[model samples]
Target: MSQAAPGKSHREGISLIELTEMFPDEASATAWFEQMVWPKGKRHCPRCGCTETRKASATSGLPYYCSGCKRAFSVRIGTALERSKVPLRKWVFAIYLEMTSLKGVSSMKLHRDLKVTQKTAWFMLHRIREAWSTESASLFNGPVEVDEMYVGGRRKNMSNAKRRELKDTGRGAVGKVAVVGAKDRATKQVKAKVVESTDRATLHGFVADAAAPGATVYTDEAVAYEGMPFPHETVKHSVSEYVRDMAHTNGIESLWSMFKRAYNGTYHHLSEKHLNRYIAEYAGKHNLRNFDTINQMAAVAAGMVGKRLMYRDLIA
Candidate 1:
């Protein structure tokens, strides 16, 4: 693997060698985590936001002690990594791997690389994905392309017994889940979610949540999108009209292509329960593709704060 440039910052480039060199031990990783979590280089109590804190002891697992709150804490207190027994170095490496992998790093790959159990690796991956979740109150502005894609196996591909068990709705998407996506043409940002149905109400609700009012919306000739709140345009896929002068859902379609590739190639079987997290993982990467490794890591790290996902909560 190529090494990062000497004297260059971590955000510029991060390779395996650079990662190892930068964080050779737990102390280095802890210090770096503290810096990232508290940018001003001062440790504060997560409970009460008190700055009056000191190291608990030389060898304590809970590193910091807060005088105001009378509690012990660490950098992991309120973040996704909270209560995790995995070392800081491994967490750092996992963060780097998650951000750097284009398609996504599998739990098995993380297991082998990080030398953790497959179960632990799986949990760690989910916690890291929790950090990638982004919430924005602002709607997607500009010419937005909206589309829906079905995710699941085809009826013909299933065994005879399984086929008999499933109802033949006479539709291709009979047993598949629907994922609606919206892509901004100008910003190249994507927002997607798993929806129960692709009817007019569902599609319109997704469009309203994603796009601003009066925004130009482009989609295929789907009747569900007929009365969209935005200035709508359509390209009839059934009539071989894929594009008509900057009016097409190709942008969002490309996002679906990427998502399908990752789903089929990397994560072969995704449970419907955790499908939203998977969508968020891919959508976060799609939105932050323009940034370098460091900034991307920083962005993921920034989301780590104020979120906690426990193992029981995850499993439940």
Candidate 2:
């Protein structure tokens, strides 16, 4: 067993103490967020995109008065943090916790640490995950590993009534949800999503969306991945042939492993309706693994612009 070198984990990036020192107060946190979101130092109206905005003197919440739209808006407008009652400082702390954790941070832990209600913590987590969701069209250029996993526990472990509701009479992944993933070997970036099925069309669609044409793709012996446009290779897992030189789905398999552990340990029970959000959260963390704490936080904050999630919309 190989052990990590001493201070290996602590060597890179800002420590928790440094984070605390950097943002000692609410004003400091606000300033940091402002700098990240408005890097050009010109405050534009998020609604109208007007640069003719002035600071509101009476409002202590850093509200900006937009002369173009004649509306008063805060820095949180049009972002994931819009209309949120939670303080900016607490939001920063929650982002820090979410980014720093290797597996994930649960809403229960966030509730305890930030002194917020469980429901609020849960909402906060989902909104932050909204910030992490990527709209990038960039595809994996090099060797890409693709795989699928069934989320949720065994049907045999469910109660009789629950099993009956799901009609999960058969064994092995009958009631679980399917998620497809691809990992780029060169960039070490990952992209994953919840799929309705692991059929040929669905699997191929994911591969088409994630991988560039002419990229080498690796997977386990799944018939669904047989006829992709890219160069495809497979290892027969059922025949105990896990790896074939450079051809293996190990990278995607490792992603599923970490995702499963986080799901089982931290979240425990996940609704099928919201499973995609959870997938985005884990994938985002995996994609941003190389960034430091501040840079990670900045990256997420950058994603916040022009994205908003309402409570009603989230539930409905």
Candidate 3:
């Protein structure tokens, strides 16, 4: 197994040895969790933040007592993995697979790799995605790239007449949801949302929400962006020059490529109902693509604090 030292090369990603080394057993993972969760070592009460604590017993697993709360609780009490039946090792390992992969990993494929049932793998993937979801700051600053992509359709799914219509009309992102994104080139962070139309309201609202005041936005010559109030630069694809003076949608363009490939290659069909959750899932991974997969995993575990995703809500 590999040991991932801090400040490792981002391009190298996770080494196979490092993945294996993460868990010699469930105990190894538990120890690792203790290290992360209690780095300051005070182990304060999650409920009241009281410093007083007591151990249940060495023989009994999950032995933590909080004096302020005057109750016993386990480490999984407030995490996404809370009340989960899966082992911590499996949970952490699943996160590792999700974070390290370039495009993404599918639940079906994860079922094969992790030796879990497909249903379990699917549930696990969704839960892990919830961990990566961001809840801090309001938007990005500086130059932003905005573009739209068509996600759903098949070449042969369309009737011959419809196909001809599409061909004649030109591929203008027809019959697809308009996904708009803002990419901050300097920070390499991106935020994307699935919108209803390429209409001015949708495009402009998304851009305004994602970027800060006076920030420049970059986009292609899409009519949807007509009369935008914010300052933006456009490149004409028809003219065959994509980049002019270091301004282009290449960063966000690259994001679209990987996102589409991951969706097409894995899962295969994405239902429109829960598309936004999947959007948040991929966006979290892409936005944090620069961080350590393990560190990112740790952050997600930490973030699961005070949040809840009920199974009923998930099914609904």
Q: Name the candidate that leads on lDDT.
A: 2
Q: Which candidate model has the greater lDDT, 1 or 2? A: 2
> Whole-model Cα lDDT per candidate?
0.84, 0.85, 0.74
Tell me the lDDT of model 3 at 220: 91
Each prediction's TM-score versus the true structure: 0.90, 0.91, 0.86
lDDT of 1 by residue, 211-269 (tens): 98888999999899998778998999989999899898888898888888888888888
Q: Which ten residues in a row have the lowest lDDT in candidate 3?
A: 1-10
Rank by TM-score, highest first.
Answer: 2, 1, 3
Looking at model 3, the pairs that clash are 1-17, 2-17, 2-18
Question: Which pairs of residues clash in candidate 1, taking residues 3 or more apart in a chain or in different chains?
Answer: 11-294
After superposition, which runs of candidate 1 have C-alpha atoms over 4 Å from their true positions? Answer: 1-12, 58-60, 156-170
Residue 160, candidate 3: Cα error in Å is 5.2
Measured over all alpha carbons after superposition, the RMSD of each candidate to the real structure, in angstroms, is 4.1, 4.4, 3.5
* Pairwise TM-score winner, candidates 1 and 3: 1
Candidate 3, overall lDDT? Answer: 0.74
